[model samples]
Target: MEYCSLIQLKTTMMNNFLTLFIAAFVFISCAKEKDPIIGNPGLAAQGEWSIPLNRILDGGPGKDGIPALDEPIFVSPQEATYLDDDELVIGHSSAQESKAYSHLVMNWHEIANDWFGQEPVAVIYCPLTGTATGWHRKLNNQVTTFGVSGLLYNANVIPYDRNTDSNWSQLTLECVNGELIGTRPEMVNLLETSWSTWKTFFPDTEVLSTETGFDRSYGVYPYGSYRTSEGLIFQVKDSDDRLHPKERVHSIISGDYVKAYRFSNFPETAAGIILDNVEGQNVVVIGSQTQNFIVSFFEKQINDEVLTFSLPSDDLYTNGNFTSSVILTDQFGNNWNAFGYAVTGPNEGDQLTPTMGIMGYWFPWTSFYTTVDIYGEQ
Candidate 1:
């Protein structure tokens, strides 16, 4: 299945979403007659926006135009034949469970609202910017599902909570407008990597099913040539030409500082580890081009002790090489998985402290943090 051209995508979106936006405008018209303010107008929508209003582009589809998935379906790794090995996925995992949201389904519907055990989570992806994050589905203890506001800031998705109609900037990691202004959504750390690498490491993982209720081409990318092209469909607030705009990078954000860690900086021929620091936080980054993965975790352990990590030795574990995503062996002999969870050792049940990290295209991260730092850059 080939990607829908810009014309075809817009036509399809219009066909599916026209009625939803029609109703929105109707409500706005009625609300405007009674008072100057309206509810979710799809035009500056609501509240005094934290971002410069001029920067918010009118992403063609109006509110709920590009539908978000609710109560998404999932299948076992073997059942996910629609995915290819090299294709990437955003993973949200824990000791109890692990799930992979493939880019194939995400390209059509950018958000998937689902439950991971008892807690609600919204897997938010911005296809244009190639950024994905898992947001806890709650605000001040009240549960809510997020929807596509049909808006773009820095060419990234602006998700609004159904409970309060507040708009959130995915890359900015905060609410920029509406009732929940200035509030930041609680986030779950998500690891991004290729399907081959993920399924190899986590054979028992649940993959997001292509059986989404919406009728979309599951394997085809909706946006044409956007992934490889240097052009952005919408403008960003800031940009830097140090790296190709679409080159994917793992970013660790702390307070006001953001560090971009590239796969090129690590040894690609074989799995490698980089013990580094980001904004005073010691970190261990592991990756390999052969494995098609790169990930990071805070070096501070659950016991509050900082430990040095290295590639597993042949003599230590079972046989020749330590395969799977058990990419690190700490001095204490704990083997840590890509998700930062300890799989073996005295602290076996404990999880490594996760940093505020996300993987996305280089431009989006740089645009968000104008002063973004590139590791190994001279």
Candidate 2:
């Protein structure tokens, strides 16, 4: 890997055109009620970092610069007036409950230590890379909350476990520094979709409220034009410019192999399914641009038998009652929801295992996977 001194790295970042512009916007928009940053170099000490140490630069809030919410409050869908139908949100559903966390709230706070009924989860998100993943907060017997380290590697957030101060790369999905280095966090299923789409899937779903302890502009996007523009605030190790840098794609990864499925690649604007293999693991990806969501699941029956899936019918859409939650039906006559929950037929109440995946911008995936394949790319 290319290497440089820490000072030289910071200087190089400051010299970048986007950095200089974004640096000012971040300090003002992202920093907490206190000072701008605290300069926690704990993860940078002792040559302990997995990635190049020089690449770990101070993101203006220092440690806990952008504070992570622990057990944040939630409101009913009717109470969340801040949300609009078209606004995007990170959503997850399980046997017990379904929840939606707005990007309006997430853009300010990158992590949320939340409870899904009896289960504890951390919503790890990076607004810069536009990626969100659900991580199980418990490692072994100890339950730990994750906090923002106020550091950026490849322009993505590096979250540290509060229990051990071990740094984890959100995009890498692995511990890169501290006591737990090289460890991978256990992930849960999550999808990014428009608020209207998710609400339709689970109308009774609770919405993450703005009642977070910190005071900030929960409605405003702190990073201006970052999502739409091709420019990056920090440089990344990217080579393939096959798609626009800011274009979002849903990806499934098994070991080192990664395959991306784009919204544009879907055969129709309504929900559809794609069955393919990644690193020898069979996966089924479902998505819809018009509905505005993307998700994936491992193709297998509860008894460990392989299964294939296809849309149930076209009449569901023609009737204008297409909720998209139950988009596919397996050959075993079992109907599945977008979260892969078997809702009908023989396997009723069973759930198809979700693949190791997340929705993210095109550039960050290419940076880490290096040789990612785009599904249906011509």
What are the per-residue Cα lDDT tens digits for candidate 2 across 1-24? 245687788778778967778887
- Superposed on all Cα atoms, the candidates' RMSDs to the truth, in angstroms, are 9.3, 9.6
Give per-residue lDDT, candidate 2, residue 81: 98
In angstroms, the error of model 1 at 151 is: 0.2
Off by over 4 Å in 2: 1-47, 302-306, 313-316, 319-321
Give the true-structure RMSD of model 1: 9.3
Residue pairs in collision within model 1: none
